[model samples]
Target: MGIRHIDVRLCNGCNICVEDCPLDVLRLDEATKKAYIAYLRDCQSCFLCQSECPQDAIRCVAVHERRMPKAW
Candidate 1:
């Protein structure tokens, strides 16, 4: 679990989530002008995108549910 949801209805194409994401986990759709999770696996559960969203459209799962990397 990482980014759980993005409410497109509330989104205003502000691109805050896309710009504030430290891991580049989110992206803005050129056509729809909405933010979406482009790299779910890369999400670090930092909640930066969620907190920075002015529309409050971003939601993320807790860190305990985040995916763990496997050892090589």
Candidate 2:
């Protein structure tokens, strides 16, 4: 699965995901102080960010079915 969405409501501006993302697919918004997808295509979908997030804000979708739609 690739990185899908981030629940901004659940995110508390914690940077764990940003700090742990090996692919650097996410970053913290300096203005909103929230995590947002940065380089989506670069996402490795390892779920390291989701698992490391303390607030469980990161969400991922299964890609096994048919690679994540390129349109996304």
Candidate 3:
């Protein structure tokens, strides 16, 4: 229900998603140079990776289903 998909075919390997993930959930594959969900369980579902992805290759569950942290 967290990160649902990563379309490697459409990914440009820009590393935006990897760098923007606050939880370090995504990683850049050294071989394919594509981003992958390295720690799906650690994902907070904040949608940061999806929004920052230039290629729009990342897809996560709807915002309503996310457990976003309360901003203090």
List RMSD in Å for every model shown: 3.1, 5.1, 4.2
Ranking by TM-score: 1, 2, 3
Q: lDDT of each structure?
A: 0.85, 0.84, 0.83
Best by TM-score: 1
Distance from true location, Cα of 10 in model 3, Å: 0.6
- Minimal lDDT window, size 10, model 3: 62-71
lDDT string, candidate 3, 1-72, tens digits: 368799999999999988888888889999999989888878878888888887888889854444657888
lDDT of predicted model 1: 0.85
Model 1 misplaced regions, further than 4 Å: 64-72
**Tens-place lDDT digits, model 1, residues 1-72:** 468899999999999888888888888999999988888877888888888888898888876455467797
Error of model 1, residue 23, in angstroms: 0.4
Give one digit per residue, the lDDT tens place, for model 2 in 1-72.
388999999999979998888888888999999999988888877888878889988888746424556775
Per-residue error for 16 in candidate 1, Å, reads 0.9
TM-score of 3: 0.81
Model 1 — TM-score against the truth? 0.84
